[model samples]
Target: MGKTAPPSIVVVGSGLAGFGVLRELRRLSPDAKLTMVTLENGHFYSKPALSTALAKGNTSETLVTSSAEKMIAQLKLDARIGREAESIDRAGKALCTTGGPIPYDRLILAMGAAAYRPAIEGDAAHRAISVNQLDHYAYFREQLPDQARVLIMGSGLVGTEFANDLITNHYQVVVVDILTLPLAQLVPPAVGESVRDALASEGVEWHLDRKVVAINYVGDRAGYVATLDDGSNIEADLVLSAVGLRPNVALAQEAGIDIGIGIKVNQYGQTSDPDVYAIGDCAEYQHGISAYVTPIMAAARGIAQSALGTPTEIRFPPLAVQVKTTLLPVNLLPPARNCVGEWHSVESDVDGDKHLFIDDRGFVRGYVLTRQKTEQRVEMDTKVGELA
Candidate 1:
């Protein structure tokens, strides 16, 4: 009898989830032919660090914890870095890439999300940068000048964090958002107000409930003039578009795989094609698109097992999403999908505030903690219950 060939497994994307899956899969099935196709250099770095790197005075070199060469050798992977996965030939069981087609018995799509930049009219609008990756962060850092005036285009987690970081570094920071308050999507109005006040005290100029309609370069000042919808002009050296992220699903959609806000996946992270799986920010699970770190890390083992012939069911515990702004630390565990509830203040003190989401039946569905109160996340997690 001839020796049977080892199973071939290919992973797309080199972000946390992709790299994590490879680590687990290699441990579970040592002889499985593992290959990775990524658009990045495949280096390992902290995604959260991008927001505060400037405040901490950390460069790209310090941010990168591991090199591509080290990760490839450590995992024994055939890493095709800098190669884009153009499409997936589902029927052929191969991934078509810039480097060429690679056959696989199982494929994992962890392409992640792209930084979304909305259209703002002006010739210099293209000067705005969206820091979604390491190279983008590097370029942003390089362009920053001493006492630079920055116009931040959103007040979401990334935008606020960056604003805080820049302000801490003595840069003139201005944040413009259509939303009424900072972290409106993540916390209650009161919490958002508190954060707003904190950052404002640190000299962050907030232009809430407004949009930058246009931008034009001012060569004399070495800056750009951003005109708001209200006809107000703000001079800025740089503009950062941190509006949000749209999940990467074009390749999956082109392959005729299911896609919602992101690539749809089942309990085991299996896509429409049973042999193909997706995890991380690109994957839309039954709950929703989980872009946070904890849930992504928790899904890695189960996903790896299911991909390598096991039928392990994937389940997630109540997860907390923390906003990494040192100015006003926030920890939130959101309510279940479509759960009817309202945020009720638990305690408000000079140090911080604590609030909980109480459903109609009086069950604690979710909760929010800030500043000193954020230390009680474990206690809050235990209190997270759902509506009947």
Candidate 2:
């Protein structure tokens, strides 16, 4: 009798996570039946590059490294681009996508995440944009005028980076956040103040500790007047909502897969169903939702091994995320959720800043570096203990 063919693997995204799993899977099993489905055109590009592209004089088209055809040929997999996965039919072992139903012996959900848009009353609220994908970035670029005034909601990593990039690119930028300081969730007060001051020096305006109550259209102008909770208003040509991202887990949830902050997956990225798995921003493991690239890559490896029958458990190291703010470069290894620790700034002679999050037992749980101090990322990464 002839040998039985391996079961087909259907991957439900073409983002970094999806490609990461595909690469690792191919490396392990040469003839694995693989297929990739995505709502995008399936062009591979660095998503982090989107925020900083304008400052470097790069356009959306310049960011794409490979098209669907190129990736399909290079990876030797069936490609389904510009198609949405409507739902997962667990019983039928198939994905119901816009194009058609795709049967799979194994399934991987790498559906990344969606930009969060907060509820605010006003006529122009629907006009507020959030650039989470290449197409969205392209639209944002098209909407921007020369020397435009931009109002950004949320002062987190994406908001701050966009502020720096816009300011550097000759745009008038204003950032508003409910938090007291920029990157309030990630960095210490001192570091956040440093970032705020640095960006302020570069012509970026900050309106912290307030939320947008309304976004009204300016009188006969293609602009908006954002009314804040403090009864203040800011006039701008465009508004960007960078509040954050929520994992795309509706499909998994509908399929009866467990979900926490994201789709709950085991150490090997397996969901409630052993044959189905998840990775990247859409997945939540033991620690939490590891939305960053380093952790996603780490999980992808284990998921690939598990899908290929090796069943390798994911062990994530201290993954430090680099914030692409040119004004005040930052590298941070955030502490675990609800971790009982306090940040203490390390005295530095270099023209930069460093801080460590030490727990009750005096163990270094997390670390942050800014400007020249970011050079210590490698050393600090090696010294920090495993993340959860």
Misplaced by over 4 Å in model 1 are 1-4, 220-222, 385-388
| lDDT tens readout by residue for model 1, 1-388 | 9998878999999989999899999999888899999988899998888999987779988899999999999899999999999988988999999999999999998888999878889899988999988989999988888889999999998999999899999999999999999989878899899889989999999999999999999885758999999999999999898999999999999999999999999999999999999999999998898888888887898899998888787767777888887888999987877779799998989868999988888889888999999999988786662232
Find the 10 residues in a row with the least total lDDT in model 2.
379-388
Candidate 2 C-alpha lDDT tens digits along 1-388: 9998976899999989999899888888889999999989898888888889998787889988887788888889989888899999999999999999999989999999999889999999999999988999999999998999999999999999999999998999999999999999999999999999999998999999999999999764758999999999999999999999999999999999999999999888999989999999999888898888888888988988889888899989787899999989999999888679899988555668889999888889899998888989998898885434
TM-score against native, each model: 0.97, 0.97
Worst 10 residues of 1 by lDDT: 379-388
lDDT of 1 at 122: 89
Candidate no. 2 TM-score? 0.97
Runs with alpha carbons beyond 4 Å of true place in candidate 2 = 219-222, 386-388
